[model samples]
Target chain A: EPEVTQTPSHQVTQMGQEVILRCVPISNHLYFYWYRQILGQKVEFLVSFYNNEISEKSEIFDDQFSVERPDGSNFTLKIRSTKLEDSAMYFCASGGRETQYFGPGTRLLVL
Target chain B: AQTVTQSQPEMSVQEAETVTLSCTYDTSENNYYLFWYKQPPSRQMILVIRQEAYKQQNATENRFSVNFQKAAKSFSLKISDSQLGDTAMYFCAATGANSKLTFGKGITLSVRP
Candidate 1:
């Protein structure tokens, strides 16, 4: 079966540095999304992208965060300046309809 | 806005037995979809099953099935002949026209041999 793939299974960086988590969603899917999960918290939606523009975003998706399709296959999330609270698992997903598929996720740790 | 809820924080079942995890979602839209996803120790999210809100019949896949009560706003997952390999965290989700999914906190299930 085709699967969503993410790069850099794990990443560690300084608190004030910048980091980008990348994902390649299923080829045929149209909508893309970004979600994050704190160690013991529920997965929270960050933003949704469709037609090359952001369709919707949550309050947590502030100016510090941005997402771009960059290329035909690569969808990335860039954090302007990371903080300790930014440490978490970031998952990229895609869906043609309602049932979205998720990637393995990138575990990011900010020191 | 939609919200998916999994009341049970955790559940356990004996091998070969049947277990059910509860889920409830709040949505006013008549057209939508519900889904169940499984995450094992590797933490990879796997799609377990899906249900279209308008479909009256519940959806089943092998040992996994859903009890979708559209009127009651409930969608639950039942795993039959449970195995130790079935141990994982299960999440319930709902999506509307925006095509964005709202997920529940999730229920951790342990199938003991």
Candidate 2:
């Protein structure tokens, strides 16, 4: 089965530095999403992207976060300034319908 | 805002036994989708099964089945003949007309040998 793929399975960055997480969604998927889970917390929605624009975002997705579909296959999430609390497992998902398929996830640790 | 609640934080079952994980949600939308995802120690999210709110028939995938009660706003997962591989953190999630998924805190299931 085709699945969503993400790059840099794990990343460590300085607290004030910028970080970009990349994902390659399934080729035929039209909708993409980003979600994060703190070490011991529930998964939280970050943003949803469709037609090269943001469809919806959560309150947690503030000024520091931005998503881009720079190419037909690549979808990236950029954090302008990482905070210690920004450390978490970030997941990328894509879907043609209601069921979204998820990637393995990228573990981001901002120290 | 929509919310998913998994009342059981942890559960254990003997190998080959049947186990049920409870999940309930509060949603105002009449049409939506419910899902059960499994994350093992590897922390990789895996879609186990899904149920559509409009469908009255419960959704089942092999040994994994769901008891969905639309009126009560309940969707629970039942794992039959549980194996050791079934040990994982299970999350119940719901999505309304919007595509965003609201997930429950999760329930850890340990299938003992």
Model 1 spans with C-alpha error above 4 angstroms:
none
Over B22-87, each residue of candidate 1 has an lDDT whose tens digit, in order, gives 999999888999999998988888889999998999999999999999889999999999999999
Q: Which one wins on lDDT?
A: 2
Model 1 clash pairs? none
Lowest lDDT block of 10, candidate 2 chain A: A93-102
DockQ comparisons of all candidates to the true complex: 0.74, 0.71
lDDT of 1 by residue, A1-111 (tens): 888999889999998899999999999898999989888778888999999999999999998999999999999999989999999999999984568889999999999
Error of 1 at B34 (Å): 0.5
